[model samples]
Target: MSKIYQLVLHALGIASFSYSFSILHSLSKGESFFFSIHVISFLKNWFMVIAVPLEGLISILYWGILIYDEKLLFDKPRLPILIDLGFHLIPAICLWTDFLFFTKEFRKSHSHIFYLLLFAFSYAVWIQFYFIKFGTWPYPLLSKLESQQRVGFYFACFALCTGIYHMGAFVHTIFNKSLPVPTKQKDKAL
Candidate 1:
């Protein structure tokens, strides 16, 4: 169950990463400087980008023992052998590599969970849009769930997102503890 959940999260991450990269690249190359504002704005400010990396952390921390019974790669021969690696493995590797080697301190706030939930909520809105357009839910879980149940599912996932954010913040703190967190204002004389 959680394997499928992570697979969905991974797909969302890939899509978000693609869109963000495309918009930024278009700007850098002067290809669509004026046309990608909406996309660029969302990628720059929205929490959509973090969903997968957070899930990736969850995968790494507890790949099979805690999250689910199945492994990330399906036991049955399904799709190409490496497709699972691309979707399930590489993204997590990239996320951890970037965090361990490149990310800056205090680059994110612990309070960013609200922003993350906002992004998830926005995705929920899109899920509704997709269902209306296609007359089917975007994912199997949503499809299996009734209207209110779907809402409950999303709320539970939002709570999960909140927890993921705190975990990410903790990891970031551990990785960056040596560096002083910058303050907007210094302490004054007392």
Candidate 2:
């Protein structure tokens, strides 16, 4: 049962990652210019949003089970959850803070942080290579910004991912701890 559950969760994760990457790629290509017309329309009309969030919820559920078993989730023998939480929380904070205060509003969700980090970092590196090769960054933010600013933007993205991850972990911990334990079965006289 656990294996089946893990398989399903992993499959969902992969699907979500792929869907998100397609959207990001589309944005980079200027295929979708307007924010609402792009993301909202895609999410509302397609399977990305629902599949991605559902995948994340399943992943979190698995993590919660692990944490419940040991009262910790990060390292073997139960390292502080905070350490793992930091991994997710930092990125999430950076991404949101940078965009919200500096750049345009980008929808930040805890569900997409892991995949976003993976996609963004790889995509950013690829964009850098493209810029080196053809003198053009794929995305507007990267194209318009100075090198230092772009690097900072990447770091901010990392922080945002970490923030969202930690938030999810913390919430899972709280919920897991608060759940009612099942009553023990009383053995009757044979």
Candidate 3:
């Protein structure tokens, strides 16, 4: 993958996570802000929905491919252990935690899946265009595959990512149900 492209996506996920965290912190401290609560909530939720699956896909695909074939992912000077983990693991974990715990449950809809497909399609276009210009795919594995196989690979990724997104939502539901969460209670007369 292009370093710049990877950086941009990572930066986006990190920025969204930071923004969501700050908003949560402010709410905890009872701080007033410029934006309405609803607007803030909407934006944060949308951001999480997009970022969580993206980061999840990155981590999932990276580790999966690494295990399957290391040469496909890295060159002679491999990334340091910490740097590799930082890039491929931490963001997914952090974003998944934030999405599952901090945010309210999002309404599950077919539209969400559509959005994911749209993202996948957009990325496919970018990567293919890059390959056309550069005369090589970004990842060694991609270059090795036949064109039909590449399409199948992309479909598999889309399926896996969609599963990851739904799995988080499912787990979130279970955790919220089984745990004792704090809520405001009315005072009774003494």
Select the stronger candidate by TM-score from 2 and 3: 3
Q: What are the per-residue Cα lDDT tens digits for candidate 1 across 85-108?
A: 665566666555444443443356
Clash counts for the predictions, in order: 0, 21, 0
* Prediction 3 global C-alpha lDDT: 0.73
Backbone clashes in model 1: 0
Ranked by lDDT, the better of candidates 2 and 3 is: 3
C-alpha TM-scores of all predictions: 0.58, 0.35, 0.80
lDDT of 2 by residue, 1-190 (tens): 2323333444445454535544453456454455544654444323332333333443454355565653322222533567535433333343333222332222445556655566558746865776787664443345557889888877665665465445544544444454577999999999
**Model 3 lDDT per residue over 1-190, tens place:** 5543464465456546655644764475333666666666777776666678878888877888888888887554567788777777887787777777766646566777888798788777877997888787777788789989988988888898799889877887875665667998999989
Query: Given candidate 3, what's the lDDT at residue 88?
Result: 77
Off by over 4 Å in 2: 1-121, 175-178, 182-190
Which predicted model would earn the best lDDT? Answer: 3
The residue ranges of model 1 lying beyond 4 angstroms of the native Cα positions read 1-77, 107-111, 179-190
By lDDT, the candidates rank as: 3, 1, 2
Error of 3 at 47 (Å): 2.0
CA error at residue 189 for candidate 2, angstroms:
18
